[model samples]
Target: MSKKVLVVDDDPDVRSFVVTVLEENQYTPLVACDGVEGLEMIQKEKPDLVILDVLMPRGSGIRLYRHLKTDDALKAVPVIMFTGIALRSFLKSQKALEEFKGEKVPEPDIYLEKPVEPQELVDAIKKKI
Candidate 1:
């Protein structure tokens, strides 16, 4: 079976772009506009991976990540955060930043920045699986 990807983003263009890239690379893509819907899709579809965004009107990516961590069923699901904000910029302290490296966080197996390169996105997904 093909690996499925759930992509959550508020922007239509970003969602479209992600879906296109996933499809072009032969992965099935599911999209959601907000955290609520994205969570619902997760429950229903059980995708192989999730490509999450940092900024969404309904809820931030961190919010959704926190929620995912709370659920035992969802905790193992790999998420590749696609954020415009650089991870280093968000890391406050040197110690904390060093601790966060490759930790899957409200924890991810992998992380990626946007606008995501199609090949990079595909590589991340494959690596997660």
Candidate 2:
């Protein structure tokens, strides 16, 4: 079976696009609309890789990454953090975003601005997995 991948973003269109891309690349793609849902998917699905969006409602992707990072079960899962938030571009990244933003959030394993290039996404996945 192909490797499973989880794509988490609040934007439906982005989720659809990412799923399509992963499927086309012969990967099993799972979709989640928000960080809360993403975390649930991670726990339930245990995908080979996770693609997350940082600036999400209710929960933040960066926080989710740290949660996974510290967890013994989820620590081995590779995470790709994509965010449209511009604040990080102007600030320095730390061990976590919550510390840097102080109410904002931290950065993902890798950050991508919106309008993601298809190849960039693929490349990121390939490297992580």
Name the candidate that leads on TM-score: 1
Q: TM-score, each model? A: 0.84, 0.82
1-43, model 1: which lDDT tens digit per residue? Answer: 7889999999899899999998898889999998889999999
Q: Clash pairs of candidate 1?
A: 104-107, 104-108
Model 1 regions lying over 4 Å from their true place: 89-106
- Candidate 2 at residue 92, lDDT? 47
Cα-based lDDT at residue 23, candidate 2 = 85
Off by over 4 Å in 2: 87-108
Clashes of 1: 2
- Name the weakest run of 10 consecutive residues (lDDT summed) in model 1: 89-98
Model 2 whole-model lDDT (C-alpha atoms): 0.79
What does candidate 2 score in Cα RMSD to the true structure? 3.5
Model 2: colliding residue pairs: 97-105, 97-106, 98-106
Model 2 is weakest, by summed lDDT over 10 consecutive residues, at: 87-96
Q: What is the clash count of model 2?
A: 3
